[model samples]
Structure formats: C-alpha cells, structure tokens
Target chain A: MTSVRQRLVPYWLLAPGLIWLIVFFVIPMYYMGELSLKTGSIDTGYQLTWAFSNYTDAISQYSTQFFRAFYYAGVATLLCLLIGYPLAYAIAFKAGRWKNLMLFAVVAPFFTTYLIRTIAWKTILDDSSPVVSFLKTIHLVPQDGRVLATSAAVIAGLTYNFLPFMVLPLFAALERVDIRLLEAGKDLYASATQTFLRITLPITMPGIVAGVLLTFIPASGDYVNATFLGGTNQAMIGNVIQSKYLVVRDYSEAAALSFTLMAIILVALIVYIKFAGTEALMGDEEEAE
Target chain B: MEGSSDLPPTDPESDQPGETAGNTARSGSGGVRLEGVTKKFGDFAAVHDMDLDIADGEFFTMLGPSGCGKTTTLRMIAGFEQPTTGKVLIDGSDVAGLPAYKRPTNTVFQSYALFPHMTLEENVGFGLKRQKVPKAEIKKRVAGELERVGLSREAKRKPNQLSGGQQQRVALARALVNLPKVLLLDEPLGALDLKLRKGLQVQLKEIQRDVGITFVYVTHDQEEALTMSDRIAVMNEGMIEQCADPETVYDRPSTTFVAGFIGVSNLMPAVAKGPGEIEIADGPTVPTADAAQFSSGEKCFAVVRPEKLTVSLPENAPGDQPGIDGIVESSLYLGTSTQMAIKVADDVNMTVLVPNASEDARQHLPGGGAKVRLNWLPEHMHLVAESDPGGSDADQTSTDQVTEGVNS
Candidate 1:
C-alpha cells in the first residue's frame, strides 16, 4: 500500500496544474467551439442549432483579410529571422564579456508596453518625421509618400515587436552547438563560409525553427499593430475578428474567425515543419541516442 | 629526422638508435618540424620554446599531464593555434600564417567531433567534397575508407546512432580519408571505458602502421603512449622532459619528472659512495650501474620500478646482501599481480609488485605490519638527479595507471 502511495505522489503533485488547465483551457475552448457553430445576433442570444454555415460566412467575408494576416506575418517572420539570427549569433559566439549586456538590450524593449512601442514606431515614421524626410531626400520614398498607415508599417511593427521572441530561442540553440564541430570542419579543409554553411548553420537549425514558430504564431493573430499602423486596405483577420466581437457584437462570427485562424496556423505549421525537416526539432533527444 | 625524405617511411633507417638525437634536418615532403615554437596565452606560457621534428610515417606521441602543453603543441602544428613566436614547418615549407583549412594536416578531436547531421559516408567524404572531388569517386573512396575502419555497414547511419567506440572509428575513417600528410589525434580514446580503450589502442596503432601517415597523437595516459608511439616525447611544465623510443624512455628516463610521470618511481635520496655503490637516505648502501655517473658524496635519487623490487621474508633474504627492512602497510591482489605498500621509514614508503605465479605464492606474501626485506638488481636501480620543485607537484593527480605494467 505504501509503494502504491509512493507512485501516486507524482500525480498528486501534478493535480493542481492539470486541474487549472482543464478548468481554464479545455472548458473555455469547448464553449468557444460551440459558440463558433451557433447562429444568432447578440440581442437574440446565440443558439447552437448546428449552424456550421457561420464558418463559411466567416471565411467568405474575411478571406482577403485572412490572406493579408498570414502574408504580413510571413514577411515579418522572415525579417525577424534575417535580423535576429545575426544578432543572436553575435551574442552566442563573439560578444565575449559583453554578451550579457547585448542580450539584455535585445529584451529591453519589453519593459515598455508593446502597444506603446508600436505607437512609438508610428511617431518615428510619421510623414514629417526625419526618417521619412531622409528617405525622400534619398528618393527612396516620393516626397508625397507617407510611412504610417501602410503595409510596410504593419510588417515592420510586427518584426520589431516579435524580434526578441526569435532571438532568445536562436541564442539558446546556437549556444548549444559544440565549438569543436566548427573546428573539425575547418580542419577538414572547409573554408570559412563553407564551414558556416555546412556545420554551423545545420547545427543551429533547431534554433531557427523555434524562432520562426514563436514569431509567426503570435504575429499572425496580432491585432494592435494592424489597427494602429495599417489602413483599412491593410487590415488583417485579427482586425476583423476584434471589430466583429467588440464593435459589431457578432460573437459567433468572431469565434468562427478565431477557430479558422487557429486551424490555418496549425496546418501551416505542419507544412513548414515538414519542409524544414522534423529531425532538427527532435535534436536533443536524437543526439542523446 | 635521420630518415631521408625520398625513402618510404617504413625504411629501417627511421627507427635506428639516436635517430631522435636532434641531429638530422628534414629536407623534403612527409614530415613536420617546429622550430623554437612558443605559445603564450597572455602572461602564461602554455608551450615553451620547443623544437621537434616528426619523421614521415612515424607514430610520435606528445605524452604529458594536463596543462603540460601537449595539446597546444598539436594545435600549433595543425595551424589551429598560431605560435607566439617561431615557425612551424610541414613538408619542409614554413607554414607560418597558414590556416587549418589550408594546412596539409587533419586532427581527430578528443570528443570525436563528428557532424551529427551527416551520415557516416558524408562525414568521411567531407574533405573530398570540400576539394570538389567527383561524386562517383567520393562515394567509392568513402566506402573504401569506411571499410578500412570496419564500419562499411554503418555508412548510412548518423554519428549519434553509433556506439562511442563506433563513433571513434568513424572519426578515424573521416580523418584517414583525407590522406593528410600528418594525422593529429587529441586523446581520442579518453572517453571510452578501459576495456574498450585498450582494444582501440591496438587497432589505432595497427591502422597507423598500415597507412604510413606521420601520426602526432597527444595523450596523458602513459601506458597508451608507450604501447602506441614509436617515439614518445614526455612533457613537463612547458618543455619536453625526454623524447625517445618507449623502451628507452621507460628504462632510462632522463629526468626525475620523466621517471615519476611515466610510471610509479620509488625515488630514494642517496649518495654515490663509489662506482656501483650508493648509500640511501641514512639507510642501507645500495648498488646501481648509474652510480658510476655520480661522484662520491654527490646527491641523487635511486629510482626503481615497483616491479623491480623483490619482497621476501627476512629469513629468506640473502644473508650478506643489504636491503631496506620495511613493514607491509597494505596489500592489494590484482589478478595477474600483487601490489603491496611497504613502509621503509617513518616518512618514506615504497610499493612492490609481485606476479601471482601460483595461489600459494600470493598466499605466502606478507600482509599489513609484517616485516619484509626489499631488494633489486644493480642494473634495475637508476640514479636520477634530485627532483626539481617545478616538476614535482604537476603530475601527482594525473590518471596514469602505473601498475598496468611498465614497458621496460
């Protein structure tokens, strides 16, 4: 009886966290899923009459916004990778005594609210701001052109806001790569660039995958940056869902839109993971084997 | 250095006595030379001014304890580390500023740093692929090298899939596939269990013999160095204490550091009384062939291996011969041999090894606190200079199994 009780101790320890998840996640998710299938206005109250047509309606009305959300998120994820990778790589391998300070700087923007930071970008890219005037003088942007209320502004904001998410995982992964492997590559007659491509890059693939997932997932559902920086033409699925739920009081459509966005993300993640190779995702366990 | 460059490295002239007397200068391909090489890490000198010439196809080992600069020396030769001052020559050409990729040398790292993502064949063919070898030829040679290391079946498997010893074999095959002018190994078997390490030692030596590539292996394991190296350079501090064939190094170590570091040395403070006679630390007068080298009244150490000392009951000892009388402090029965610690004096102790010829013989050996007499032949007693303070404390904690049996 004591031995059985000893085995039960671990479950007992885990019960609180499990209870919280079931209460908060499972219950709410089930209710929202049912709401996604109901058909009614807020004044009439929603009724779950197996009204699956809300999904079709949500998809048809918000298809362009859905595509735009994913497009901006994809571009932002790519930009984060381009900027975060080198920044993280420098911190991991080259920063020496300054590494901790550089890493702290990467996360410093989080001290300010993210919405405020996005608004700060709006001020920085205002039409009369020096950045826009400089771009005009360089003829990169026409004199009449504006940086705010554009898709570029939204994408840039998403990249900036989610960059730390990309950097931290990449840093963790790149830091785990054995220095001896790089030396071995050089010893085997690989040039510097070849060594980076053949050894350093492949070994840090898990970090890249993790960074992309962390950046892409939240960026796709982000509503604040689109509302503040993007015009109506640049509005995304997140904007539609937000306005539908809070402004138009269409809870069913909002829930349907949320479920569709989640489903699209899940499918896209599976496809991305497939092309990038799942072996790197299981890197630590594979190495232990 | 004594061997001519044109001769195939297997020529008998290569291992002739005194070939490593620092006399011969290499003229052409198939050798590496370090001329006054010194590596300093800021204020610390890791490798002092070192001059060494490794002959073509010879298995040379840089044997030392940790922090003794053997790995640093290997790194300088591989061009992974630049010498603080002086030149490193490969095939008689000064490769002063060359990088590792450009150097005609490859290193098998201690960790067996195989690319975890690459298959065995891809790993073994990496150097060839770097040189852009034709695809079919790369595949063929990769297969051939894999078979050479007895890993042909593991060609498609990733490095992580293989066992530790198997991964080591892959590392070996990968390095050998490059056909480098010199192969450097940095304690490659340091991670394996003892039984596996011993097995790999013989295989690694045989592979070196078969390939005829000048192998510069660094290891702190003295027995491994002795068994595998054609010549071993015993290092202390940042300098080479002694460099010679294994037998010569074991039998006639040039310094106190070499004697103690290579194996367990029972060093007794003694005075040279006359030729073939020496008086131990206020104890009995002993005989040694090396006593002739020292003048009477000069201080030296009478060094002898534990196996050389014969332990016997007082009654059974030779009647007239003088020997140190000690009480057995401890006795350990190793399968093939027996080890006993004998307390010769309050502050002095000596270890003795006796082969277990029969169960009766081991049973008859003295146990704790039993009186015993110790003696050895005059030729077995080596008179070394007094221990230098700088070298005494370094290798005490190093894990060299001195009781595994000395080469001598």
Candidate 2:
C-alpha cells in the first residue's frame, strides 16, 4: 500500500496541469475535430453527419491563402534572422558593461500591447508620413506608390513584431559561446570573417534553429498584421479563418482551416527538428545523457 | 590513404603552396623580440615597460602567478593584443599593424579551446584548409599531426565526445599542424590533474624539441617552468624579476620575488655586519663569500633554499659560520624527504629539507618541540635586497588588480 501511494505521488503532482490541459485544450480540440467533419447551417442549427467534404472544400478554395501565409511567414522569419543575429551577437560578445541594458532594450517592446505596436507601424508607414516621403525622395519607392496597405508593410510588421522572439533565443545561445574559441580561431590563422562563419555561427546553431521556429510558427497563423496593414489581395489563411468563424459564421469551414494550419505546422516542425539534429533540441543536457 | 594519388608531388618544406610567401619566411625558425612593451587596460598597467628577446627554437616560459601580465605579454606576442607603447618584432620584422591571423603564430589556449562542433580531423585541418592547401596534403598532414599527438584513432570524434586530456591533444595538434613559425601556449596544461600535467609536460618538451619551433609558454606552475623551459622569465607585478636558465634561476635569484616564487626559500632579515659577514635579526652572524655586493650595515635578506640547510648537533670548527639554535616546530614526511620547520628566533622560522638517502639521516630528525641546530655553508647564503614584502605581496596586488578590473 505504501509503495502504491509513493508511485501515485508523481501523478498527483501532475494532476492539476494535466487536468487543465485536458479541459481547456484536449476536449476543445476533440469538439473542434468533430465540428470540422459535421454538416452545419445556421438556419437549422448544426447537424453532425460526418461531412468530411468540408476539409476538401476548405483546402481547394483557400489554397492561395495557405501558400501566401507560409510565403510571408518564411520571408519574415528570414528577415528576423538577418536583422536579429547581429543585434544578439553585439549584445552578447561586444556590449561590455552595457550588456544588461542592451538585453533590456531587446525585450522592451513587450511593455506595450502588441496590437498597439502594430497600429503604430501603420501610422509610421502612412502615405504622408516622413518615412514614406523620405523613401519616395530617395527613389526607393515610386512617387505615386504608397507604403501602407502593401505586402511590404505587412511583412515589415511581422518581422518587427517577431524580432524579439528571434533575438532572445539567439542571445541566450550566443551568450554561452566561449570567447576563447573565437580567439583560438584567430590564433589558428583564420580571418575574422572566417572565424565568425566557421566558429561563431556553427556553435550558435541551436539558437538560430530555436529563433527560426519561434518566429515562423506564429507569423504563419497571424491575422492582425494582415488586417491592419495588408490589402484583401494579401490576406493570409489566418485572415480567412477569422472571417469564416466570426463574420461568415461558417463553423465547419473555420474548424477545418484551423486543423489544416495545425497539421502543416506540425509537419514543418518535425522536418525542421530532423534537420537541426536532436542533440541541439536537448540543449546542454545532451552531454549528461 | 589513397587520397594522395590525385595530387602532384610537393615539397614538405614549402609551408603553403598557394599562399604568398610573406608569412612563410620565418617558418620553422623564428625569434621574438619585445622592445619597451607595456600593456595598459584603461589606466591600470598590466605589463610595464618590458624588453625581452626569445631565441629561435627555444622553449621560453613567462612564469608568474595569475594576473601578473604573463598572459597579457603572451597575447601581445601572438598579435591578439597591441602594445600600448612598444614594438613587438617577430623574425626581425615589427608586426605592429598585423592581426593575429596574418601573423605566422599560433596559440594553444589555456582552456584548450577546441572547436566543439567540429570533429578532431576537421579541427586539425582548419588552418591548412584556410590557407587553401591541397586537399590531399591536408588529409595527409592532419593524419600525421594526429598521430604525433597520439590521437589518430579519434579523428572522426567531435571535441565534446573526447575526454579533457584528449581534447587538449587535439588543441595541440590543431596549432602544430599549421607549422607556424612561433607557437604560443598560454598555460596549456593548467586545467589538467597533477599526473596528467606531469606526463604532458614531458611530452610537450619532447614535441618542442622534435619540431624545432620557437615555443613561448606561459605558466605559473614553477615546477612546469623548471622542468620544460630552456629559460624562464620570472614576472612580478608586470615586471620581470629575473630571466635565466632553470639552474641559474634556482641557484642565483636576483630579486626576493624570484627567490620566493620559484621555490621555497628561507628568507631571514639580516644586516651586513662587515666584509664577508652578515648578522641575522636577533640571531647569529653568518659569513659569506661576497660581502662586496652589499655595504656595511646594509639591510638585506639571507635567502637560502631549504635543501641547502642541514640540521644536526651544534658543533663547529674554528673559523666556521656559526649555526642557529632552534626548536623543531613541525616535521612533514614527504615521500623522498622530510621537511622540518625550526623556530630559530621569536619570529624567524627556518626550514630544512632532510633527504632520506640513508637510515642514519632519517634517524637524526628530532621530534616536535625538541631543540636542534640549523647550519649551512657560507657560500650557499644568497643576499637579495629587501623589497616590498615578498611573493605574497606580489600575489595579493595582482589579485586586487584583477578584482578591480572586474568591479569597474
């Protein structure tokens, strides 16, 4: 009896969180799965006839939105990497006494609501704003062209919003890199560029992988940035799902779209993990194991 | 092994076939000369005005406690650091503006900073590949260097997969494969255990001899310095107290810092009594051969090694130096010898090392609290000018400097 109680202690400790996940997540997911297969109409109330055609219809009609969502997310994630890598490297290895301050600044955007931040970007890229006017003056944008309500603006918003997610992981990873290894690279007659590419970058691969995943996952299903900054032509899968659920009240189609997005993300994550190597995913504990 | 068939025959003496010969001129034979080199981090001088000349094919060591500017000096030589006020010349050419990569020098870091992501083979071949050495040549040289370090079997293993000692060998092979003119080792054996450090010390010396490359080794372990170096520079508070061969350094230390740091020394306060004699504080007057090095009544320290002093019955011939009467305070039986601490005076304690060469010698050591006599020949007494305390002060000041740098 005592041994059985001892065995059950671990399960008892896990009871709260496990129950919460089941109630709030697993059960809702099961109902949504059922909803995706049900034949539904508002006038006659919803009826469950196992209408699996809802998935096929959703995918065939909204294939463009699915492709656009992944494309924009991919480009935004790449931009975050190119921009956040140097920021993280500088803060981790080069900031000296200002390291803490720079780190605080990296996460400082979290103080304000994310929606407000996206709205601020919309204002900043307004047609008559100085930024757009300056871009026009520099001939970067044609004089007749505008910055707001364009795919560029939407991508710019996603990159900006997700940049901190990219930076913190990269910073944490880059911070653990030994300065001695870098010096050893130079001592071994590797140029600065070579040292960075061959030594610094490879050692921080785990961070890069983590940052890419964090930025890509949410950016793929995001709708607010599109709603605020992009046109109807640039609408993503998340925008389509949001309109289907609320504006059109098409529950079955919306449920099908949500499941499809989740499935795609899950598959992408698996492929990414396979390529990045499991040793990295396990982190510092890999050595002990 | 068949990878060499595709490459044309090439002379091994040529450092790198595709690269310009500028970096190869000093290959295999390079000497370093530092003229008035001083390094300053902000206003705190880590190394004072230093002038040192290291010969080609010499195993030279900069020996000092931590934070005494030995590592800083080594970094300057490796081109990782530029001197604040002096020139660092390698092979008769000043490399003031050259970066570490452009200089024909490699360093085995104290931490053995092996690239954790790369396998041993890739790490060993890194420099050659950067120089664009032929692929076949890279493979052959990498294997040879790995075998030299006795790690050929572990070539495909990542650095993290190997033990600390194995990783250390990999670091050594990585630098040595490049065949640089000068190899700088910044306390490379510092992180190893005693047995491993001792074993590697012999191997390191042998490899240096075999390669005939100028090795600038920095270490604080006096035994490591004595055992491996052809010559050692004893540094204290950013200044070199003495630079000499191991025997000369142990036999004739110029400064109290050198005498105290390199080994255990019985430093007793004394005053020059007259020609050929000096009187210890509240103790006996001891005779010396060279009283000319000091003036009459000048303050000095009578520095004598523990091995030089003998403990025996109080009996002496006429005209012989008088022995000190002391009570044995403690005796520690080290494997080959017994070290006894004798309180000669109220505050002065003298140490004597009694070798267990014979049964009779071991029988003569007295129990604790027993009276004994400590004596040494007049010629063995070394006179060092009284300087700021001794090694403890030098160690403490360097510690304070390190903490100050951190806190600021």
CAPRI grade of model 2: medium
lDDT of 1 by residue, A120-192 (tens): 9888888889988998999988888888899999999999999999999999988888999999999999999
Q: Encode model 1's per-residue lDDT on B1-408: one tens digit a residue.
A: 221211113335433212321212212227889999999999999999999989988999999888999999999999889999989998889999999999989899899999998999999999999989899978877876776566666689888877788888789888877788899999999988776787778878877766678999999888899999999998877889889999988888877778788777676778889888899985898767787888989988777788888999988997655578889998887788888889887756787889999999898898898999998777777888854645456335321445444322
Cα lDDT computed for each candidate against the true fold: 0.85, 0.85
lDDT of 2: 0.85
The C-alpha interface RMSD of every prediction is 1.4, 2.1
Q: List where candidate 2 sits over 4 angstroms from the true fold.
A: A1-13, A42-47, A284-289, B1-27, B315-322, B357-364, B388-408
- By TM-score, the best candidate is 1
Tell me the lDDT of model 2 at A11. Answer: 100
Residue range A217-238, candidate 2, lDDT tens digits: 9999999999999989889999
